[model samples]
Target: MKWMPFSFICLLALGGCQAVPSSLPYADPPPSQACYFPSAASSTLTASVDVLTEWGFSLDASDTRLGLLSASRERELHGASDLYASPHFSSRTSLSVFGGMGIGGRSHLGVGLGGGFGQLPIEVERVSLLWDNHHVRVSRDIRRFDQYGSLRTGRSASTDDFCARFQRALDANTATGDSPS
Candidate 1:
């Protein structure tokens, strides 16, 4: 009887599995969380995204096959971060972090996970990840009202402004005339 397969499985299951490496080439954390985590992270990225958000991603999807289905698969997600980008803000800054998992080896079932972050043009940031061959990255840059705008105008319209606007819209909608029964 060949016990090799059983031994290999035991080793992997017992925390002897090798770690998975990051897929990006960036040297810092992603500037925004929404873009990076969503884009690069594998299917089960919510928890990591939440943590990054809690840590701040405004800085800040899925897979199948190989039985890596998010719906009915037993898996674990791991994430790592370095304060490479400092909590500083410029016209454009970036925060980058990597998230991924070591799916089971030859014996264990498939596990899926991945993530990454990147920013550009001193304002637009894309923090994303890739799962196997799928692209799940996203971008969160300052929304531009006019192409020929100055720093003042650009600063006035950022994710923060959008959030504030959204909040106001929600408040106005619920505060006065509309209430769900």
Candidate 2:
């Protein structure tokens, strides 16, 4: 009856409603800094790059004199729908007969076709390194999108593995006479 159109509109509005922000207070923790290597800045930077590459990250930036380095990697985490794409032709046919004697016949035809694969979710990672005369400092940040395609909070990634591997790499470099006495 007359209420049918109103009900359909309400259903669509409710179904597409956006999620509310949580009332619970939350904050991203500060990036962790650690002096895990006891090698000269240059040597530490080299070792850091090696560790990063070994862990599947490519070198994004580096400064030998400043003892700074950055690396990043990507991984697919989820699937997302592609917003662009078109499907093959689709045909719909409909015929209707009016109940009243005033109207003879009415017809409506609707055809819809859509096709596309959702884009896969990708996690982006970035790692930064800094070193001084006696120690090396490292920090990491990871970025990812939520199901709604909204950029979620970015937080520091684990430095434990990097620290361990960097230590070994620095030790090797020093053994080859790369470290300062």
Candidate 3:
């Protein structure tokens, strides 16, 4: 009978729980086309790198001979309310003293401290990129966990900003290398 309240509370907590939201539906990549600089693979790779760097991504992997490249960017989300519990803000203090002299004296004291609310610190965004023969594929993944520890994944739309810059860079490279015959 004494444990009935505890059991009921546990049941209620479980009943209120739900799974984290699922990721967005996958979308097929656009049709592949010949690169702007068909004969200049080096220039194409350089342009891809430049565009990726301009967009705040760093090179993670690359294979010049194979014409493969990968890049990623990471950032933390800020400005969220602190309405959860955290051990970082919870603390305890204790002091004890005992002495014997002309008269016996003894004293003991203890103290505990904790904050009412804490920040979850669980919002982050990551972007990954892959460069193939004549195309660059980009994927943005967002990860966040709630106070209840439920993790969620989100999808970000394709970024045409980099693509536009890449095309321009390729055009410039090809135009400059060709001289009057």
Candidate that scores best on lDDT = 2
Error of 1 at 4 (Å): 82
Model 3 poorest 10 in a row by lDDT: 30-39
lDDT for each residue of candidate 1 in 1-181, tens digit (9 for 90 to 100):
5999998889889885566676855423333332322122232344323333443343223333431212111111112122222232222223334334555554444443322232221233223323343333322333222111223212222244433433343234434333456
For model 2, state the Cα shift of residue 42 in Å. 4.5
Instruction: Output the worst ten-in-a-row residue range by lDDT, candidate 1.
Output: 71-80
Clashing pairs in 2: 80-118, 80-119, 81-118, 82-118
Give per-residue CA lDDT, model 2, range 30-129, as digits (tens).
Answer: 4334335456544566566666787799999888788788899988664332221122311112232323234338655555534223444467888777
Predicted candidate 3 versus true structure: per-residue lDDT over 1-181, tens digit per residue: 9999999999999988967768875634431232222333436567666766876778888887766667766553343324333444431222333333453386545455444233343654554445555554545445665443556544453446544455675556546545455
Greater TM-score among 1 and 3 belongs to: 3
Q: Specify the highest-TM-score model's number.
A: 2
- Report residue 18 deviation for candidate 1 (angstroms): 51
Local distance difference test, candidate 2: 0.62
Give model 1's clash tally: 26
Ranking by lDDT: 2, 3, 1
User: Against the unseen true structure, what C-alpha lDDT does each candidate score?
Assistant: 0.33, 0.62, 0.53
Candidate 1 local lDDT, residue 107? 46
